[model samples]
Target: MLGPETLSTPPQSPLVPVLPAYIPPDVDMDVVLAEVAADGVSAAPADESGLQRVVADAQQQGIDLKVVVIDTNPPIDTPLRDIATVVAQSHPDATVLVLSPSFAGTHSQVFDRVTLEAGEDLAKTGNPVQSAQNFVDQLNTPDFPWTGLTIVLTVGVLLAAVLTRMLQVRAKSADAPKPQADTASADS
Candidate 1:
């Protein structure tokens, strides 16, 4: 998870552009275009100013600002990957930032679940960035993925302890000397 300062810092290396090789059939260009427009991006291939607007909007929405604008459409199955690969191949060390409406769904889900578990109202966070950071922190917690294996191991340890205690108690009682009753002399 990136802090606000890290997000604001410009990338040290130049970002390499990667476009999707194929556009998925299900991708609705009109919907995509409308979303772009809403982001204040007037052109498919956003110019410098348009990119800045995108970065600003994303920062406001609590998204990473290292963006890789995909000018052309890509296959639905690997839309984000196709673009990422291109940039990755050219700039192996650079981070790939994909901006798409599709991402909004999953991001919201992550934020919601994290906030729910924290017992905090999402609105109280006051910004998308904070919400996103909280979600990331939740994910990074040491016991984040509490797996079935962990549960089983814990139960096994507890059962062993109880059984050991019970055996110790039984052995101690069995080893004790039997109690003897004293008999009084019979009356003449």
Candidate 2:
């Protein structure tokens, strides 16, 4: 499994840049500002000071910021819960997102309970539209369900082969036992 550091780093820019820095005149600044103002911040703090940066930024903006902390194989004495408590105390409105990639089952349940009680949104993060599209595409793809057209074609070929073999076996078995009578007459 990839460590928290790997997941926390923002994906590097592609080999080719997708967009230029300047915005065209046709684009409305108000709309852009609104989008920017509404945008949420995501972060993974390694320590208390790192966590403070996000809370401070959200407080300054007067908008709720979502904080995500990723920890892999954290120790029992880790300050994750304490950090979360501090964040909630400092920024009551902000939602903190916590993900534990290394732990599953009961460990996740405990985390979920804590996050919910604290009024935070806890889950793995990614593009929702892309995630939905991927699921839809997988369902639509030909190979997912094995009992579709491909299976029917394969079964038809196998049945045809079995019938052909049965016919050949019957024809050989049905041949007369004339040679036995000839041998008996020769012996007589």
Which candidate should be chosen as best, given TM-score against the real structure?
1
* Model 2 lDDT per residue over 44-117, tens place: 32333443454455447443443433344344312334434434444455443333343111112222353343
Highest lDDT among the candidates is held by which one? 1
In the order shown, the candidates' Cα RMSDs to the true structure are 17.2, 19.4
- Backbone clash pairs for candidate 1 read 22-75, 23-74, 24-74, 24-75, 24-76
**Regions of model 2 farther than 4 Å from truth:** 1-42, 45-69, 74-143, 153-161, 178-188
Q: Whole-model Cα lDDT per candidate?
A: 0.43, 0.39
Candidate 2, residue 10: CA error in Å? 49
TM-score of each: 0.33, 0.24
Error of 2 at 138 (Å): 8.3
Lowest-sum lDDT 10-residue window in model 2: 102-111
Candidate 1 residue lDDT tens string, 97-154: 3333323111222233443344222212423334334433443355555588899999
lDDT of 2 at 14: 54
